[model samples]
Target: MRCQTCGDATSPEHHECQRCYTPLGQPAVTPGLPTYRVRGIGLAANVAVGATAVLYLVVALYPLIGMVMARRAMANDDPDLLVSALIISAVVALIMTVAQLTAAVLVIIWTWRARKNTDAFPGAEPAFGPGWAIAGWLVPFANFVVPARVVAGVARDSLWRRATPPLVAVWWCSWLVFSIGERLATRADDRAYEKLAETPFDDAGYQAYVDHYQDALLRNTVPALGCVIAAVTLILLIQRISAAQEARIAHATPQWPTAPIWPAQVWPAAQPASGVQSAPGAQSASGVPGVQPAAAAQPLSEVPGAAPAS
Candidate 1:
């Protein structure tokens, strides 16, 4: 229907006109995702999340470097340096943890909004919502199993419009398995150290346990890194999908003409017949008196011998 206020086309589904932003009583406006507006917001939110993530990484790096240096100092019997490094590591780790968690929260919020915008468009479903939100992150023991699956589900739904993407599902399962294994390994290492504290440790046994625990921790880092890398890759993939979807919508929409083209080039101009002069005064074709020039321009009621104009 055409909007009564602005005469812009609107859809029966919407009560407000998209073009004029007016409340529609009878007329309507065009129906669509309003892609341009939604994408702008989505992109801004995404950028904010990315910036926060970068800040998290910066904070995290200091702790990691400090931890390595502290361990080296301990081995070398540098007591003063070891204590300083430990303090620095604790501070950096605390800051890093807080920043990382905050960034994750922002990411979830941004993705949720983006999903809503996607739903407004055709051929799109909400990929980020409460269901996925709860499943996506830490929640006691539940965190160990749900997050990988949540990531895969969100990706599959948003990018493929499916409940699962084959590759993503398989990789996510592997992530969950490795994550559980990592936690179990960590617990076992702690238990071993507790046993050593109870029983006096021989130099050989203590060194051997230390070596083994260090190896286990090193191995677990691989999977943990894999999960992080995967998350980053998936986010980039989602961004590409957003761009592609926008391009498709732009291509499909009808375009208006830049300027009007008239038919003057196609038809010949009309010419008067010989001796058929155009009227100068009040004269008609059959020699009858024509209406005055003033009357001709006035209402037909005032013009004698002229038909009323509709």
Candidate 2:
């Protein structure tokens, strides 16, 4: 049968269309199962994440910009310019941080909704419960693995048990790299600051501290690149899963036929066959059972004016 929504051809056994996941016919509603309405949040999530990715690109330029500014300031012996550059970089970093947090929240909400919708799909068994969609990102060590698993489950169940794309793994790996690399860079900065504090008065030690700080700033590019990659891949994944869920929801909804109903006609009863005679007390030739033929016509002897019968 062709799907009513997408016009895709599907087998009689399939309740939903393969292309759009729209229900082929009226689907049976299971008793006691709560209905989950799937909403399209992918676009919003993508916008936020795409913005975050762009900000990551800007953040990546920070280390290179910082190193150049530092060197030029040192060469020109202008301390003020160096201070100004640092302040600008700080402001940009702050903005990027806010955007990242906002994107994360939107993504979590989208995933939660998607996971919940899987319950409404026929034969869709998600690996994780809907709660994990949020909690997976909050738990410390488990966050590394759980969030990916949750996303994978949503993808698999949403696409009618299809295999998840490699993009999920790529996104997870990049996210891990960005997270770990950022932590290392932060620690390195802290150690460099501690050393500088210990030798505040030594000119040679101060020079070494400056070089260390510049090197640390340069190293930030790795994590920044990782963040960029992670954001892009995540946006794609979100779009795919959201679209699939929407299709599935469309399939589940009941659609009433639009054609008008006409009243049925009452057929008249059958008549006996013409010119066919039946013996007296016999059934009619029309083949109507238990219906005897009319009484035979009166004889001439029974007429009043006729001579008496012998």
Residue 282's lDDT within candidate 1 is 49
Candidate 2 C-alpha lDDT tens digits along 1-310: 6665455678877777676454666332233556454444678878888898788677666656766665665656555655666588779979988988988898888988888777766555588999999999999998989999999888777655467668888999999999899889768866765664442334444455467657776777788888888988988788777776677556557778898976554322443355333334544444544453344323445645766657
Q: Write the per-residue lDDT of candidate 1 for residues 189-261, one digit (tens) a residue.
A: 4565465322213444334434544554554454455445444554564475456445544544667878876
- Pairs of residues clashing in candidate 1: 9-29, 9-30, 10-28, 10-29
lDDT winner among the candidates? 2
TM-score of 2: 0.68
Candidate 2 ranges beyond 4 A from true positions: 1-40, 193-214, 256-310
Give the least accurate 10-residue stretch of model 1, judged by summed lDDT.
291-300
TM-score of each: 0.46, 0.68
Distance from true location, Cα of 308 in model 2, Å = 65
Candidate 1's TM-score reads: 0.46
